[model samples]
Target: MSAGSPVNLVVLVEERSADEALRALLPKITPGVAFRIAPFDGKEDLLRKLPHRFREYTYYWRAVNSRVVVLVDRDDDDCLELKAQLSRMAKEAGLPAEAVLFRIVIEELEAWFLGDVPAVHAAYPRVSLDLVKRVKFREPEDVPGGAWEALEHLFQQHGYHKKGLAKMIAARDIAPHMDVENNRSQSFQVFRDGLRRLVSEEN
Candidate 1:
């Protein structure tokens, strides 16, 4: 696609927490990408809200005109049905299955902060079961406090070694911290800046 074209992203999340986090992270990770964050209160909401017509709109209008479409969803069992439905919708829309991406973050927004469980524990020697569980099963109300603090601790405690699986975890964990409404607009800006720096040094 041409540089002038916008990168269209269709993100589906089970709760407000995941929605807000995806909203915060996408633009930062992929600059100039235009996104729509659709929040489903639950499995029923997703099935009812995302009709075949919307799928057509996504495929024909947005997909055709944009550079890419990144679809993010949670990995709960309830979401399995939705995933299959989306896949079929994508095919009907004439888009390649690969063109419709999935970032199934296990156990919702907390997964962003904790990364993979074993990796997180390895990084933080003092982590307790409560802290671990909280990070793994975080709700919307669970955010805006210790969540960000824990993530910051992860980065600091790990010495900011941004590479390999560790870097992936760091990026995923730090991404959700930017979802505070006041900070949303600047999320993409900060992420893009950091990504650029990382890429430059890597090369």
Candidate 2:
């Protein structure tokens, strides 16, 4: 682990979108830790396939540097269950829990990008206004007509709701949009730089 050497990271995600979002945002969020996105087919794939994949990559990562990170999204109500399973797997593999990081956004991945009820409706128009309001906690008047239609059209064009499409869209397209909207460039840099300074001081 020499200074200036890239920190190797292993991302355990199912789709290209998650890969892209993590690749774009993680380095900005944690400087000095360069990462690469490695995809697994899906949750079922993880169950059936991850042990082999993890074994293969774990050896590779240890050879380079004993640093790695795993990220996954909890897609539905089974999120907590998934985390427990992953935790058990990590322990069995002799990896500390901190070596893996998990994030379960409270809502669909799309919510991470749009943030507000109206913005989500604008991005996804086909959903019923009532449903959108229920999810986003905003009044119907807050959403303009035609916004939902446009969003629905966008989702359809992108083939959303199809198998594995939502994750792809979130990582590749929507996350970047949210990053920019949230001024993530500045925020991430600040957090990274501050963390580095703190680490150096403690050392």
Candidate 3:
């Protein structure tokens, strides 16, 4: 691809919130490798359509330079089992392994925001800078009582999203200020590294 040409990276996400978060984050990591995020109504919807999507992508794969990433929240499911299912679907669709990357968020997208307290603080000035020093939040993926609930409580304490967490809004506010290199969430780090590796392999 030329300096100005679009990068052929495609990211398939479970919800608008994931899309919103990645919109701000991908650019930071990918730099000149422009990407596209395709969000489904929800995880179930994405899984329902993934097989067909993979099949259709055969055209894109043959006709253009491209890669697809399927990202989902692990929720209450077994992470390894979920990954195996996704891999099976992609393989059944006959997609080359290099053409797709499947990633499962440990609990949810909010964990990524919690990964970098500085980013959250930068976006919400009321959020305490000392938050990361606390035991509960020091580990983003393992945030006590779950990531989404922890973030909701934190945001509420900071006087934002008092009426429950508005995911897309939170993503919009927090993601732009996130530092890719400084995130402490192991899952987020894996995602960042995997995406960079995928993009680099194309060159």
Candidate 4:
């Protein structure tokens, strides 16, 4: 938050874990900026409601001095096509492109945890960064198979969370430990940049 640039941010997240992660991460990123999380049941729900939501937000935010960031997982879709689709949705919603920002966490939110190996270590404490370092995808965010599943498998092999991953717990444990400056995921870079741009101006 820059001096005199008051911002109210509405984060439209795809999952509960995303909501939990952003709830912890955003305030650390933008101190003094007012923001709230609007979590969807999942990716499908977010896409289904996005057009209407954008239209409603356009009208409502005008009175509240606010802006919105729509966050989703790319999830096997063509990233360029997905972004263009969202742009079209916003335009059809009667909202200007400048009024809202869209960001995709490629694969899924957990890939972000893999991006910052130290954060993952800090969260789980037993997983070795060396194991994460040896994965085929150099950038974990670009992993083809579900990133969350990969993370679960890793932990499961190591005798942690044998039942299953609790997404909320994983998010809460890892997000606060993420080092913003050290993450290698391009998607994380885009998200960070988008947030900065969104809050750079006075609402």
Query: Which of the predicted structures, 1 or 2, would earn the higher lDDT when compared with the native?
Result: 2
Cα RMSD to native, each candidate? 12.1, 7.7, 2.2, 2.6
Please rank every candidate by lDDT, starting with the best. 3, 4, 2, 1
Model 4, which residues run further than 4 Å from truth?
A: 1-5, 135-137
Error of 1 at 165 (Å): 28
Best by TM-score: 3
Model 3 — which ten-residue stretch has the worst lDDT? 1-10
Pairs with steric clashes in candidate 4:
none
Quantify how close model 4 is to the true structure by its C-alpha RMSD in Å: 2.6
Model 3 C-alpha lDDT versus the unseen true structure: 0.89
Tens-place lDDT per residue, model 2, 1-203, is 45444445555666555566666666555556646677667656756666666566555554554344444545554767876876676667666543445444333333343333333344455534345434333322122332233344445665565443355554454443333334312223333344343223132
Among residues 3 or more apart in sequence or in different chains, the pairs in candidate 2 whose N, CA or C atoms overlap within 3 Å are 17-171, 17-172, 18-171, 123-151, 125-148, 125-151, 125-152
Give TM per candidate. Answer: 0.47, 0.57, 0.94, 0.90
Summarize candidate 1's per-residue lDDT along 1-203 as a digit string, tens digits: 34335445555655665555555566556556566776667656664655553565555654344322323344445456656776676666565543344333333344344433343444444444355355333442234443445455545655554332343354444454443222212223333443333223131
Question: Over all chains combined, what TM-score does candidate 1 have?
Answer: 0.47
State each model's CA lDDT, in order: 0.46, 0.48, 0.89, 0.83
Q: After superposition, how far is residue 195 of candidate 4 from its true place, in Å?
A: 0.9
